[model samples]
Target: GDQSWTCFLSADNFKGPIAYYIPETWSKIGKLFNYPFLYGRGLDARPGIMGGGAMEINTVPCFEATDAQGRVYSRIPKLQFPVDAQGRAYLVQDVAYYSKAALYDAVKSWRDGGPACSGRFNENGCFKPKLNTRTTRYSQAGKRIAGVERFFDTRIFEGNVWGLQWFTNDRSETGVFPRYFKDEGEERVVAAEAEVPAETNLLVQNFKLAKQGAPYTSPTVGAWANPGPKLGPFNVKLADGSVVTYSWYRFIDQPSFQQYRWSEEKKAKLQAFVEKLHASWSIDRDYMPPPTRGRLVALDPALLVTPPKGLEVGYVPIVTGQAAQ
Candidate 1:
């Protein structure tokens, strides 16, 4: 809980052609359109320092999902980042949570078809129809929908950015980490905020393992900072006055690592396909600027401590059979 999250927004929101408010994904006619990792694309892709020579940069919207009784069960994509479209940069979808494996596979296949996938958008109707240029996935009441699991599926991590590795948890379709991390302890509150200085180099730390470098961000709206495939407990910041502070909270899914030998031809084709996707470009004149920083105070440092300072550290006493060796 002592760790931190990260987020990055473009410099053009205040000066761009349009502004995109991510909570509703393009709610304004003049704002750049944005979507969380769960839905899909809004602005056109530009360029960045990561994947595709571009990256997503923006403030993330946090929407809570709940059931009939108003019991919160799942929250969709938690963050978003931006990419360049033509010569301009725009926020794109970059993160998501898979509450159920069945639903996850279904939705993923519907949007991004690939290995083991069997669904697609127009054919399955998994998504609600888009209402307007600034609208997508609205409820019957026509309000934006979020805060509950309409379908069943295992929770999953769907974003990859920076030069991070991938990892996964083998939880059953009914369970997920981070989403479930809170269940194991008391509630987590946004205890405090630290004002970030502008113009700083960014780096992140994935808690489960040791690695340091620029951290990964979601390509969609509403994402927190994390080490994409590796998972996190991370910290981020802006070092100069040119930009304020950016932070994001990220969860990880580390799959078992291994090597599968591939022949030259197969590897070459795969690499080329990926390259082509990265090369496509456009100019998304619309963009959303991040809200200015209001609070720069550091989080309550007291929250970072373990063992309650003077109390004895808790440890399980392991029993040794026969005191051997």
Candidate 2:
């Protein structure tokens, strides 16, 4: 089945500062697999409908998860974390597609109302009442344009303080993983650190396996000077019968930066900055404003965490990618 190949589509007019699959393509892929986990990104150089028709959209039997809850949390055992037959796990772009769809649907509903205005606008005294009137086009361009605006509403870009996206001196960071949640309602739980292979790191091990002998430098995962308040001990059992462990670390506290080649002084400075944030910011408070147009899904109460002591809360982080991060 071409299910082994995965493809991404991005467009300028489309939603988000993030990449989004065009509606037609998303519908096609959705029909193939409600929660599809492909082995690799097809063949890199091949070019066609889907990277040179690598996807067997019609013939492959659609795969489904047995767990009722597992269906919504697509990044769990069956979908996002699967190890291919070759024993490789690729980095997943852990966005909650279901939540994304819900956002799309909300915009559609709003547009169906046939609103006159395209988006939220401010007037400096010369406002007309007809500007807020309903029109049939709202179901068409109104919805489409509104959806695009809703997607990029967040401050999830570099240089923004307290948004989903963050940036360092060298790079910009985003995507779901190392998410925080309440102990009882946490969307997904991973393995304990002790269960995984102590000698081999998951990021490094998986990086080499995925690279398949390509000439690439091994990446590093750094450690925090004062590791505090985290969740996990959650585990993912690989196809090779090995288990990998992960946890939910604060956005800044996560080991993502360590994967790069940075000077010790730089690392220490970042860690110090993280420590300062940890002391000041509570995870429970909302740093970014709520979405004005469409409903933002997956900010579930069940997934709510009672910020432990000094720690507080913010965005509902859902990891849609592989554990290699």
Cα-based TM-score, every candidate: 0.17, 0.23
In angstroms, the error of model 1 at 168 is 44
The reply for model 1, stretches above 4 Å from the true place, is 1-126, 129-258, 282-325
- Per-residue lDDT of model 1, residues 130-208, tens digit only: 1112111223122333321221111211232222111232321212112211011223211101211111111121124
Q: Would you list the C-alpha lDDT of every candidate in the order shown?
A: 0.24, 0.29
> Candidate 2 lDDT (Cα, whole model)?
0.29
Error of 2 at 214 (Å): 25
Per lDDT, the best of the predicted structures is 2
User: Which 10 consecutive positions of candidate 1 have the poorest summed lDDT?
Assistant: 249-258
**Residue-wise lDDT of candidate 2 within 61-178, one digit each (tens)?**
1111222332211111111232334322232111221221223333333434532322111122121121111111111111121221111112322221212222221111122222
List clash counts for every candidate, in order.
77, 19
